[model samples]
Target: MKTPKITIDRIKKYLAEGKRFDGRKPEEFRDLEIEFGVSKKAEGSARVKLGNTEVIVGIKMGVSEPYPDSPNKGNLMVTAELLPLSSPRIEAGPPRFPAIELGRVIDRGLRESHFIDFEKLCIEPGKKVWTLFVDIYTINDDGNLLDAGGIGAVAALMNAKIPKYDEENSRVLHDEHSEENVPLTKERPISITGYKVGDKILFDPTREEEDAGETKVTVGISHGIISSMQKGNETDLDTEMFGEMIDMAEKVWQDLVTKIEKFIK
Candidate 1:
């Protein structure tokens, strides 16, 4: 069922008073918390919290042949599952469109940004290469699932440890005696999300604002470049508003990136 019009009217009144229904300012965001390497079973894992919304990401690396089209590049796969346990709205079984879209967006942001050193994952060229699989699970659905999932995936990837391989045989070997945990390279990318509510904007929206937003812009900022961008809703955005949003995003992105990166194991 949709939110009652009376409730929305109250929210509007609150906004006009420079307050949020959840008791936050127009530009304030909910608290964020992160945990890295939370799972021992996976190669890497992380848990992220944006207010009440929660997400878990796991990274698994294995030996596989590279795709024919991009033989030189290692495989990187991202998938998101909206667990029915997370929220009553989530259906059981296969992933829904929203989950798929979230995964694809995060995947595009990382891959297109060249955040991971795929070339370094190559073992025996096209014959064998390391495949990075990132699995995102929604454990809670208060709101802002997109940002939570994206940050979780990136954190998990950063915390991942590559498996030991036998250079002599060109295969992943079971040599516990000589095994070593190959840490990821030095560089990592960061992402930022901005929401446009009425004529105002905010960084890292709260659960209430996320649900109330008329439009949003998610930008992946990495290595002095705009790695990726996703715009939601058909609401028109003027040049001035767009510029203001971008400016706010950049300022907040610096702090968000620092905090998230610090949790990289």
Candidate 2:
């Protein structure tokens, strides 16, 4: 459901003062909490909460033929479902644009950053390769599901174990896990999203602030470098706004990554 104009006006007034109802700075994110292995069946799973926004990500492995171009490398498939229970706006049906966008964004970030070592996942050159399925589900819609999802995706992959492969049968033994973890690189990508409403910009906004947004800029950063950027909504932004967000994203990554490091194993 759309936020009422009255609430939007209140958000704008608070934003003008560089304050949020939660008392966070314009560029500050809400408290983040992560839980690993939320699903026993999945090879890897995580639940991440950025304030009231929450997303659950799970990783599953399957054996599949390698793509013609990347015969020696495995594949990555990212999917997201924004459940009807998560918000009043969502409906029970096939994924809509928002859910589709969320998957693509996270997939691009992971692929661009080379977060996973796909070559290592190959079972046989030009034949069988491991395909990692990253599934995301929204449990709440307090806003900023994009960022929370990014965190959940990374956490789930890190928490995943390589399911054993039976070479003779060319099958993935889901019940048996290998001792090795998923082949992840040293770099990790995190999504930093900025919302512009009226004359103010906020990161990790509440649902009301998000509904009042004129535009949104989301960037995926790893090791102080931006891997991908996406713009949402109809409002056009000038070069100055883009520049400001880049700077903001870089700085935010430094802080955000630090907070996430403590949870890594």
For each of the candidates, the C-alpha root-mean-square deviation to the true structure, in angstroms, is: 2.8, 1.0
lDDT (10s digit) by residue, model 2, range 185-215: 9888998898888877788888888999999
Best by TM-score: 2
Q: Which stretches of candidate 2 lie over 4 Å from their true place?
A: none
lDDT values, one for every candidate: 0.75, 0.90
Q: Give the poorly placed runs of model 1, Cα more than 4 Å off.
A: 166-187
Give the clashing residue pairs of candidate 1, or none: none
- TM-score list, all predictions: 0.87, 0.98
lDDT of 2 at 44: 96
